[model samples]
Target chain A: MTAVLDRAAPAPTPLRRDRRRWVWGLAAVGLVGWALVASGLFSGPVLNPAGSGQFGRFAAAALRPELDPGFLRVLADSALVTVAYAVLGAGLAVVGGALGALAVARTTWGRRRTGWLVARGVVAVPRGLHEAVWGLLLVNVLGLDPWVGVLAIAIPFAAVTATVFAGILDEVPRAAYTALLAAGAGRTTAALYGLLPLATGRLLSYAFYRLECAVRSAVVLGLIGAGGLGYQLALSFASLRWEQVWTTVYALAALCLLADLGGRTVRHRVAEPRPGAGRDRVLSGAVLAVVALTAWAGWYLALSPATLWSVRAREQLDYVLSAAWPPSTEGPLLREVLGAAVDTVLMSVLAIAFATAGAVALAGVAACPHRAGPARRAVGGVVRAVLLLLRAVPPPVWALVLLFVMLPGILPGALALGVYTLGVLGRLVGEAVEEADRRPRETLLAAGATSAGAWLYGTAPALVGPVLALAAYRWEVAVRDAVLVGLLGAGGIGVVLSAATSSFDWPAVTTVLTAIVALSLCIDLLADRARAALR
Target chain B: MAVGERVAVVGASGAGKSTLLGVLDGTVPPTAGHVEVHGTDPAGLRGRALRRLRARTGTVRQHLDLPGPLRVVHNVNAGRLGSWSAARAAWSLLAPQGTAEVRAALDRVGLADRVHERTDRLSGGQRQRVAVARLLVQRPELVLADEPASALDPALADVVLELLGSLAVAGGGALVAALHDPALALRHCDRVVGLEHGRVVLDAPAASLGVTALEGFYGVSR
Candidate 1:
C-alpha cells in the first residue's frame, strides 16, 4: 500500500542508471520548454481580429449557401475532382509502395547487403516529410494542377504504405516462403504465391484507408490553387465570405464522412465470411466504380495530356521553385523565422501531449465491452463522434474558427493540432488497448481489483510500447500541422512562409522551406529512435 | 493456516484461460467474483502490494510466453522480476547476471547451453523450458498455469509437467493448472480438480482420479 514498498527494486547495474538519467534529462528539457510557451510569456501577435465584420459577412453568405446554384455546381465539380485526385494518387501510391516495400522487406533485402541499407535509407527520408510538404515541392516542379496534388499525395503516402507493406511481408509465415524456395520457386514466385495471398486482405484494407487520407490531403492541396474543395474554402476565407466557407466546409465534411463510412464497410466485408467460393463481387464492383469515376473526373478537370505541356503549367512550376529553393538570410526576417520555428516546435509538443493524455483516457473506456453500459456507451459514442468531427474539419478550418475565439498565438494552433491528432492517436490507442492480451487485466480483475486498477497494472505495461509508438507518430504529424497553423498568424515558421509567399519574397520563402524540412527530418529521427526503443 | 480453496471457471470456446493467468499475476481484473490469494485480497492491493503479489506468483500459459526477442537466460531471469528492480530487469535483458542460477534452471529443464541464445530461435519444448526457468526465478508460494502443455507433444508435455511439479514442490508452492490431459495431471499433481461447465465437478487426491471420475466430470462416461 505504501509508495516505498511499491518502488521497483533498485537498478542492478550502474550503466542503466546513466541511461535512465539521460532519458529523464531529455524529457525534462522538453517539458520545461513546453511549460514556458504555454505560460504565455512570449506572446507574439493579436491573431483574432474583432470589429472586422468578417464573421458577420461569412455568416450571411453561408446562410444562403443552398440558394447559390453556381457555387453548388462549383462544389460538385470540386468534389468530383477531389475524388479523382485521391483515386489516381492512391493507385500510383499502391504500385510504388508495393515496389518500395519489396525493396525494403527483410525477406527480399535481408539476403543482400548494400541494396538493403540503401533501400532502408530511401524509405526513411521520404516518410520523414509530410504529404503537404511533398505537395508543395511537387506543385512547384509540376505546376499548380491536379498532377501536382496527385504526385504530392503519392510520394509520402507511398513511402508510408511501403513501410507498412514491408511489415506485412515480414509477418508472412516464413514457413510458406521457405517451402516455396525449397521447391525451386523464384523469389518473385514465392512472393506472389506465398506472401501475396496472406497480405492481400491487409494490403487492400490499408490502401482503402490511404484513399480516405488522400482525399483529405487533396483538399489541403487545393489550398495552394490546385483546384479542389480546399481551394474553394481558401478563396472563401480570403474574401471574408463565411457563408460560402461554411457551405464548402460542409461539403468537405460530407465527403470525408462518406469516404470513412465506405472504407469501413469495405474493410468489414473483406474481413467477414465469403458467401460462396467465387471472387468478391462487391470488391470488384467498388474498385471498378472508383476507377471509372476517377478517370472520368480527371478528364472533366481538364487534366488531359495537353495540360502537361501547357505554358501556364511551366510558368507555375517556375514560380514554385523560384520561391521554394535558396532561402533568404536577411537579418530581421531570419529572427522572425527562428522565432516561428521555436513556436512551431512548442505547438507540436503541447498538442501531442494533449492528444496522448486524451487518447489514454478514452482508449480504456472504448476497450472494455462489458463495463460500457448504455450511458457509458453513449458517452463513448459522443467522444468518437467528436473525434470524427475534428478529423473531418481540416486543421486550417479549425484554426480559422479558433482564431475568431482566442487571441492569435500558439494556443489556438496547438488546440487545433491537438484536436486533429486526438482523432488519430485516440483511435490507434483504443485499437491497441483492445487488441492487447486481456489475460493480465482479467487476472487483476479476478483478484478483486476494480476495472481501472486492473487496467493500470495489467493492461498499461503491454500498451506502453504501442501507446508510445502512437504518440511518437502523432508528434510527427503535429509538427506538420504546426506549420499550417502558423498560416493563421499563430506565429510560427508557417507564418513566415505565408508572408514571404504573399510578398513574392522567393529567397525568404526558400530559406523558410529549408528550415521546415530540416526540422521535420529532426523530428522524424527522434520518432524513429523512440519507436525502436519501445519495440 | 491454509484454508481450503475452491475455484471454478467456465466458459464456451475461446472464453480465455490465458486471460485467467493474467488475473493471477495482478494484470487483469475479473468482471465478477472474488479471488483472494493466501487469505489476502489481491483486489485491494495497490502499487507495492500488487507488485509484491505479482512477483511472488508463478504463472505459465499455453503458448511460450517468454519475450522471444530476448536471450533464454534473460527470459528465465524474468522470474526474478519480483526481486529485481525495473532497471535490473532491463539491464539483465542486455547482459544477464546470476549466470550459474540461470544455467542450473535451464539444465534442470534440459536446456543447459542455450542460455545465451534468443528464445525465438528455440523449439516449442525449449521455449517452454525457458518459461519454467522464469517460474523458478519467481519462487512464488503459489502457481497458476493456463493450458501450459496444450501446445506440446505428449513426451515434451510429460517433461514440462515433471519440471512444474518439482519446482512447485521445491518452492512449497500450491500449483493450480488447467490441463486438457487428465492422465498427465494425475501423474504430475498431488491433487486433481476437474472443471467442465465452469464449475468444479470432482476434487480428489491424484491416486483417486480415475477414468470414471474424469468421464463423470466431463459428462461422458467412457
Candidate 2:
C-alpha cells in the first residue's frame, strides 16, 4: 500500500507542473493583452464630435498653446483658487486628522471598546471612498463653489492622514508615554507633551506629503465645474480648443511644482533644531503668520456652516441623483462600456509595471548612505528631487502634456499614469530599503565588500519582498488614476463616464461609475493577494 | 608573555565592570579616559578603522549574545567575519568555513555534538561553552569577557573559567573577565582587582586577596 501511494504521488508531479505552467501562461496572456490595449492597438468607433480627418489640426493646435493676455488672467485666477483650496483643505485635514489620530492611538486613548471601535470605523469609512467620489457628493450638497471642493478633499484626506499619523505615533517609544501616564498625566496632556513632541518631526513630514497630494486632488475638483484649471481644461476640450487646454495644463503643472518646492522648504525649516532664542522667535513668528493666513483663507473661501447648509443645496443634490441613479445597461453602449472597463484595467497593470521598474532603479541609488562621497549623495538628492517633481504634477496635467506631444492615443495616457505612479512607488521603495535591518549590511561591509556590493547582497534580498508589495499597492492606486487620466480624452471608462455626465445621461453615468468601483475593488483584492504571497 | 598584560576585573554592585570590559573590547567607548590596546589608540578610529580595531579583540557577553535564530555553527563562524571576504562571510552562513575548525573549537569547549543545533535550544551552560568556542575561533590578541559565568551553575562556572584561563595561557593572549565571586577570580586569575564606586579599592595577587580585601571592596566589615 505504501509503494502504491508513492507511485500515485509521483504521477501527479507532471500534472502539477502542467497546472502551474497553465496559470503562468494565463497571466502572461493577460499582461500582453493589457500592453496591447495600453499601446492603443485595439480598434473602436471614435467618440470625437469632430471628424477623424481633423485629428491633425487638433494635434497642431495643442503644440502652440495659446497664452493671450486674457488666458494669462484666467490662469492666474485658477492658480489662486487652486492654492486657496489646497491650503484650506490641508488645514482642515490636519485638525481633523489630529483629533481622529488621538482617538485611535492606544497611547493616548486607552483601548476601550466603544471609543476604539468608533474611531476605527470613522477611519475606515471616509478613506474607502476616493477623493473624487467625495467631491461629487459634496458638489451635490453645497453647489459648485470652492468650499464644496475643499470639504470634499479634506474629508477623505483627513481619514488617510489620521491613519498615517496613528502609525507614526505608534512608533514613539512606549516608555516615555508610559512614564507620563504613571506621573498622573491625563490622555490629552500625554498626547501634547509626550507622544506628540516625539512624533512631531515625522508628522510634519507626512503632512507635507499629504499637502502635495491635496494640491493634485484640488485640480481634479475642477472636473465638476468648480472653476479651476480642470474646469478650464474640460471647457477647452469640449470646444476642440486644444491650445487653451494646453495652456491651462501648463499653469496647473507650474502651480504643482511651486507647491512641491514650498512644502519641501517648510518641512526643512520646521525640522531644524533652533537652539537659541533668536531662532526660536523667528520660528514661532512664522508659525503664527501661517496660522493667521490659513484662517483668513478659510473664511474667504466660504467654508462656513451657512454656505454648506443653504436652501438651494437640497434641490441641487436631488437633481444630481435623479440624473445619476439606477444605471442604464442596455443598447449599443453596453459593449462599448465593457470594452472601456477592460482598457482601464490594462492601463493600470502596464503603468504599475513601468513604475515598478523605475522605482527599483532609483531606490538602489537613493538607499546609499551619506558615506558614499559627496558626488553620490548629490546624485541621490537629484533622483529624489525628480521623484518629488513627478509626484507633484497631477496625472491629468501629465496626460495633457503627453497628449499634445504624442499621437492622441491610450499610449500617452498609460505613459502619463505610469510616470505619476513611479514617483509614488519609488519613494516607498527607497524608504523600505533605507529602513531594513542594517546589521546584515554591516556584516557585509566589515567583510571587505564595497558599499554597493553589500547593498546588493544584504539589503536587496531583505527589501525585495516589501518593495514588491509596495509596487502591488501602487498598482491599485494607478488604476484609479488611470480612470482620471481617461477624463482627459485618452480613451478609457472615465472618458465614457465624462461623456455621459456632460450629456446628462444619468443612467449611463451610473453604469460607468459602478464599473469603476468594481474594477478598483478587484485591483485592491489582487494587491492584497500579492502581499500575502510575498509574506 | 607578560604578567601584568593579563587583566583582572573586580567590582561591587553598580561599579561598571561590564562598561570597562565593553570599552576594552571596542564596544562601549570611554567618555573621558583614553584607551590604548597593544600600543594602538582605538578611540581615534572611525568606520573601517574602528571595525579593524574591533576585529583584533574577542568579546564574550554575559548573556551569550548569540544570534538566537541562527545555528550554533553559523554563530561560531561570526568570529571569522573580519578575516573572511564579504562573499566568504555570507557564504559561510550557508556552508561554514572548514567544518574541522568549527569541530575542533567545539571539541575544545566540550560542545562538539551541539555544533549543528540552534543556539537558542542550548542550555545556559552549553551556550557559555558555545561562546567560548567563538572565542577559540577568533584567536584574538586579547579576550574581554563581561561576567561570562554569572548565569551558570558553580561547577559549570568553574569549568568555563578554567577553560578561558587555559586558552589565554596557551595563546599568550591577554584575558580580562569580570566576576562577582572573589573565590573564582582568585582560583582562576593570576591577579585580582576590586572596585568600589568606580574606584579601585584593592589591587593584589590572587593569593593575597583575602576576606579583608573583599570586605573593603563591598564597604562591609567581615
> Which number leads on DockQ?
1
Q: Which stretches of candidate 2 lie over 4 Å from their true place?
A: A1-79, A91-126, A133-144, A158-212, A220-291, A298-313, A329-361, A364-373, A399-415, A425-476, A489-493, A518-535, B1-222
Q: Please give the lDDT score at residue A32 for candidate 1.
A: 46
* Chain A only: TM-score per candidate: 0.81, 0.70
What C-alpha root-mean-square deviation, in Å, does candidate 1 show against the real structure? 8.7
Each candidate's DockQ: 0.07, 0.05
lDDT of 2 by residue, A100-197 (tens): 88778765566576877777766766665566666765765676677778888899889888888988998888787778889999867876788878
Off by over 4 Å in 1: A1-32, A38-77, A96-144, A158-199, A235-250, A267-276, A315-336, A366-368, B1-222
**Residue A51 displacement in candidate 1 (angstroms):** 8.7
Chain A in model 2: its TM-score? 0.70
Alpha carbon deviation, residue A358, candidate 2 (Å): 4.3
Q: What clash count does candidate 1 reach?
A: 32
Per-candidate clashes, comma-separated: 32, 1
Q: State how far residue A290 of model 1 sits from its true place (Å).
A: 2.4
